[model samples]
Each structure stands twice: as structure tokens, then as C-alpha cells.
Target: MPAVPGRLRAVCLAAAVAAVLTGCSSSDDGSGTGSGTGSGEPSVAETPRMTLTAGTELPLDAYERSEDDVYALAKAQNVLTEQCMKRYGLAYDAPDPSPPAHIRPNARIFGLVDAGEAARYGYGSVARTGPAPTKPKSAVLGETAKSVLFGPKTKKSGKALAEMPMSQTAAEKKKSGLVVNGSPVPVGGCLRESYLKLYAPTSSSVDIMYVFNLKGEAESRALSDSRVKKATKAWSACMKKAGYVTAAPASAARDLGFSGEAATGPGAVTAAKADVACKAEVNYAGIRFAVQSAYEKRSADRNAETLGLLREQAQDRLRLASQLTS
Candidate 1:
């Protein structure tokens, strides 16, 4: 729910050697936003209320960064990190950042909406149902390069270097007191330094996760709203009529025992197609999306001041990222 699901958190920390990039990486919310590297889409807050569709931009979107923004920021970070590694006489070429394919950003937020997708991959995402992508070959790092790229292991604690606390500022890097290749390894090495440069430039920088937390809260509220519940019940009845018994669309895949490889089987595909049809018949997605948007509007209003600050910080980062990448 926190934009960056637990599964993608490792990708965020894997600053070095991200060879096979996909659609959404860090801060992915199963939902997509609009263009530009700035805050987000125009204020849907003032617009007249209308029936919402799958992948429709919500009001809180103004405070959120789009997937394009996340990728641009990541590429800039990679460029900066590679440049830092060059300073230490190590050759490093960071791969472009991307999210997994077939994930139509919020397409499945309430349940599958695309009939074609349901027929092909069933409950599984394209990334999971299709063949794995080939990983690009990267240069192997020697001990010296590894030590400089990722800080050396602690002597006393025997802690994994990757698990070490990372410094988010230059001052913190300096205080870490780590030296590699006749130079200071910024707290958690060049990766952490690149992160600090792009994300947390100052000690007082607001956390990037702040907006996502608010979005998640609103989504949670929308789930329990009476209108959404009513729609879900109608969808359930429709699915039952189609010979697929399930309590809710959200749990259909699990209830049907579809997991991993089984999700892509013919049986799953048939059920998935039926599931999507039922959702459409009952207007489930429209109802849930509308209710969720209303909740997001309320949350945005309550946190307007903080959201404004976060938006400004995001814009600043995007500007700097452009310069760094260019």
C-alpha cells in the first residue's frame, strides 16, 4: 500500500547492476499518473465529479510523482553513481531503471479490468505469466571496486555491508569516517552518496514516502465505504451467476487456488475472463474508483501544506536529475 510494495523494495536498494529493468520500480503503487517530472496531473479537485474508470487520475495525484518521474530520477541516480565510481578509477555502467511489464499501473487496483489481459494471463501479471527477460551482462567488480562501490564489512559486528545504516547527507558521510581508495566512501558507499545527492540533499528533506502514505490511507478508507461494498456484492453475484463463486473480486484469484504457475493455466484464464466480465457488468471498478477518489480528495485537503512542500521538493529533484542525466 505504501507505493513501493515490499517485493520491489530490494530493487530500490540494489543501486548497482540493475540489468533487467521493467515498468515500475521504487514507489510503484499499482497505479499510474500523468506526464512531466513536476508534482503531477492538474488539480482534479476542482473538476465536476464524474464516473471514474480504470487508471483514471485521482485528486491526490497532484501530490504524487508519475512513473516517468520515478524512472527519470532513477536514471539520474544511476548516472551520478557511475560518475562517482569513475572518480575512484572503477568502471561502472548502471543499467536504466524500469518497472515490470504487463503491470497497467492501477489496472488491478479494484480487480482486473482488461478482458484481453484476463484471457491471456489470467490472474498473473505479464511479467509473471510470460517468459523471463534476458539479463544484460555487466562488468564484474573486483575487491577494490566492490569495497568502493559498497562499503567494507564491519570488523567487530560482522554485519552485512548492505545492511549497514546509510547516511543521507554529505555531513553524515563525512562523520561515517570510512575511507576507500584514498577517498571517503560516502556512508554506504557511492550508491548511498548518489541517493543522498538526488533524494535527501539536506538533513531537513521531507521523506519521499509521505505522499504515498496518504494515498494508501485513502485507499484503505475507500475499501470499507458502503458504496464500494455494495458494488462488490453485485460483482460477486454476477460472478456466481457465471459459475465462479467468490466473496469479492480482490480475492477471486486466491479463492480459485490460482498461484504462481497455476495462475497462467487454462482454467485460471477462463475464470479470470469471467471475473473481469462480472466486474464490468456490475460497474465495480467505476464505483470503487469514484469512492477512492473522494477519499483521496479529503486526504489531500487535510494535508495540503505538507503536500505542497513535498511537491516542491520533488520538482527540485526532477530539475537536478535532468541536469545530472543530461
Candidate 2:
């Protein structure tokens, strides 16, 4: 069958539902609390952990090490001990009168160690689990937003797909039955969607993924139940209150997963799978809104780079969708 188009009007209606329904963040410790296993006792659910092999770089080691050892290491590395202390909420022991000079703390360094520890021992950082701020839908809507949303469907050929402009491909995809709010959107108009793949080395790994969607000049709507909408709205509202601007033209966000050997080799593979079939459409919003929402909601729990990459992809896709639609 010829695909349905995603109409702005329909999208607006859907946005209304979504605005009231999607997005949220978790705590800084990465733990989800709940009842124990049939014990009727309150339980502090532990967050999933990650492991790191030897020769890996770790930044937070300074914070995790003995204060004296860290002090010595910092001095040797030409890092200002006091500044490093402050960054990780430790007491400064150096007596330089004024704060030490040129002690640049690297988030990457800290993150490497933090991630390694989490992987090896299954414990995440408290500060890393805090909720991120919220963002607005307008932040993502750009000059080409309309075109990408209504653009053409994208083919699967590596070269053809790569050669096809994002906006044009989005337009084509809209015509191929991609629906938002139960209406047909014209190819080359205003929205976009795509799929991603993720992998988990062990069944114990959290393997969680998120799918975000944003809309403009319209409220967010939810296709699912109220719980999902409520969670998303809470997350979105938090981001808006935090001062982020949406910068993408169009986009879609989703979490991907894999298991066993597939998770161990390579990272993860991208695949075309139905959203409904996977039961993965927990939350959806515009690109910018979704980015902010995810950051504000899960920023502390996940790798900052991972979140940043996801946001970038969403924004890029949005731009492509707009181009195709226009």
C-alpha cells in the first residue's frame, strides 16, 4: 500500500497528547527503588554496572583514590590539586593561598574511570545519576523543519541512502506509511523518524534505550497510556525550566539493544524494526525537546557522550527530514 503522510495538523494534535505525556529523568546513583522479591520489604534496587579492561583510561581515579595519593598524582600530572578536589567535592589540602593555577579537570578522564568502575564492580556514581534539565520544542524546529518532516522515504542501500539528502529521504518515508497522530503527512513537510540498534554483553546489563520525538507549533501527545505521558511531561517540564534551546529541524530518538555474542562483538547493529512490534515507544517528542528531556531525565545515569551523540543524531535526522519534506 502507498504510505500515509504525516500531517502537521495531526502532529499538532498528537503533540498536545505528548506534551501532557512524555519524558523524565532518574537519580544520580542510578538505582531504582522498589519492593523486594516477594519479601514485602522496601528495597534499594542497585543500578546496572559496567566493566573496564586493563589499559583503559579513567578520570575519576583521582577522586576514588586516597586523598594523599590523588594529591601526589595530580601534582605529577601538572593538574591543580585544589581544583581537582573541588570538582569532585573533596576538601583541598594544598596551601597555595590562592587556588592552584591551570588545573584543568577532564570530564573524559573522570568518566572513563567512573564507567570502568561501574562496569567492573556494578556501582555507578552518585553525581552521575542526577536528573538533567529540560528543553523546549521550539529549540529544535529550524528553517528546514517543515521540509524534513514531509520528505521522501529513505532506501536501505548504503551508497544510495548515503547519497540521498536527509530531507528528501524523510519525505519519501512519510509517503511510505510512517504515521504520527493517525494522519497522513505530506512528503517534504515537517517530521522525521528512524531506527537504531543497541547491544548488551550480558543479560544483566541494563540495555535500556530511549526514543525521542519533537513537534513544533503544537503540543506533544501520547499514543499510549497516561503513565507514559505523565512521565514524559514531567521530564520535558524539568528541561524547559533548565534553559536549553532546541536546535534541530526534525528528528526521532530511540534506544537499541542486542544480547549474547552480538553484544560482545562490535558495538551494536542498526536494523529496521517496527516500533510497535518492539514495544519500545515508551516516550516520543520533537528532537530538541526529546534531547533536553533525556538529558534532564537520564543525564547522570548515562555516559554524557552517549547522550550527546544521541542528541546530535536526532538533530541531524531532523534537518534531513526537513530537507526531504521541503
Candidate 3:
């Protein structure tokens, strides 16, 4: 039976995001050396011995060529293996034909091979014997709500929502305020139509992207309701009871016939925006809530980050919807 090393097992279970970010290859076999023995008949009293070197390059077929060739390959492979083990703090072992079940193929290992070759030939970070593996593209998503909301859906196409021109003048026309609580918040001009375009980055995995879009729509609707005045008032009372300050309604001049309140906390760099948008035709109303909070985490770090970023983006969508409905 092939021995399954513990270190290799750990790499297979690491988070995909961490794997991508750390630039570590999961497919690397912890055992770096190969061995072979001479086939010719030997004296009964003689013991066969082999020589090895660490940090050298060897071809994959070197073992099949000759005793000298096998020795050279074994030495080189052992050297490369030793260097990697030292770098990662893993145990060294001879190569095994059957590796662990979880071990996957990685192109990055080829790079290490090339580096070993280089080290052998006086070339820094170049391999002297076999071909090195290829480096995969880092999965980074684009900066559109739509892109992030839909991952692989957008990854293959490389399409994102159109960017709209930022306009302070347009915001002013609607009686919107700038620098809410000194946070320098930009009032989006096309808040209503823009909701249709916001996408999450593409590099994000599928599950995370779906949650972002789903939550974004939910929060957007909640903020745009005309009945949000009562909800905001209730929420404000709750906040005050919880030791937060109460927010005030918008002034008549700045009010676009929409009912809502804007409040700032004592130490808040920005104020929260809450409003109600009425849709009599559909008999539906929306209550918008907009606020920023420090990113929070849950049990899993990556999941927590995804949720935190999604929540922030959802709040932005709500803010935009408030402007449109107002």
C-alpha cells in the first residue's frame, strides 16, 4: 500500500480562496525523491549503495536510463524535495506511485522543477531537467454588483454592467445632500435604474455570488417602501432605547415628496438614510435603510467576508433606490 502523508492531506482541505491568495499549489506531492537500484548480478557479500544530492534537477525518465542516470535524478529530486520541505516545514520522503486520494494535479509544481533545474545549472529559479507546471490565473472578480452577484455566469463572458457618469448636478436637482455626517457620501444620480446594473465581481465563487444578489434585492425593496416612515420611526425608537441617537426627517426643500428620516450617530462619520417609496399602481410600498458598519465575521472567515461585502453593497443599493423613489 502507498503511504499517505499527513501534510499533503492538509493542503487538500484548505479553503479555495486561501489557496488562490497564498499562491500555494495543492497538487504538490510531499515526497520529492525517486529511487532505483542496479539490475546487474552482484557478489553475495557486497551491499549495493547509492548516492544522492539535494536541490538538484532530474528528468522524469532518468530512472529508466541507467544506474548513473538514476543516481543523478534521485540526487536532484531529493535536493528539490528537501528545499520545499524546509520552506513548508514538511517531512521528506521518497516518491510513491500512489498518492493520497485528495491530491489533485497542479501546474505550479512544474515551476518548482524548473527552478531546481536552474539551481543545478547556475540559473536562479530555473529548472535544469524536466518541464515545470503552469501557473493558473488568480480568480479575482470584476467590480460590478451584477458580476459579483453572478460569478461563473459572468466569468466566461467577461461582461459587466455599464458604468454611469457621476453627476453632483443631477443629485442637486433632486435636492440631495452631500457629505452626509462628513463621510463625503456621493449621491448616485441614476439610483433607480442603476440597481439593475450593480453586479458582484466574477472571481467570487457561485454560492457567494448568489447570496449577494438575493440579499441585495431584498434590502433594496425594504428601503424603497413609502411605509418606511413608520418603520424608521420604530427602528429609531429601538435604536434610542439601545443607546443610539434618533434621526430627523428630511427638510421640505430637500424632500422629493418622499417621506423619510436621516440620522447621524455621535461618532458616526456618515449618517443613515431611511425612506419610504409608494407605488400605488402595484399597491406596494418600500422602506429603504442605508448604513455602514464595520465588516463582521461568522464561523468561517471566507464566508464572513463574502457576507460582509455583500451587506455593504446591498446598503448602497438601498441608498440608490431611496433617491429614485424619493
Residue 166, model 3: Cα distance from true site in angstroms:
29
Q: Residues 1-326, candidate 2, lDDT per residue (tens digit)?
A: 00011111101112222243222223211212222112111122121111222232121121122323323332332223233333323333332222222222322221222232323322122233323423322333332332234333455532212222234333344353433444443332222222110112123222123321121101122122233344344433433333322211011112223334442223322111221111123223232222222222222233345444444543443344344334
lDDT for model 2:
0.27
* lDDT of the structure predicted as candidate 1: 0.64
TM, every model = 0.73, 0.15, 0.15
The window of 10 residues in a row where model 2 has the poorest summed lDDT is: 1-10
lDDT of 1 by residue, 143-234 (tens): 77776676666778755444444236544635345565687765567787788778777866777788788878878876776555666777
Q: Write the per-residue lDDT of candidate 3 for residues 57-99, one digit (tens) a residue.
A: 2111111123332233334434443333333233344332221
lDDT of candidates 1 onward, in order: 0.64, 0.27, 0.26
| RMSD from true fold, candidate 2 | 26.6
Assess the local accuracy of residue 42 in candidate 3 as a C-alpha lDDT between 0 and 100. Answer: 9
Count backbone overlaps in model 2.
93
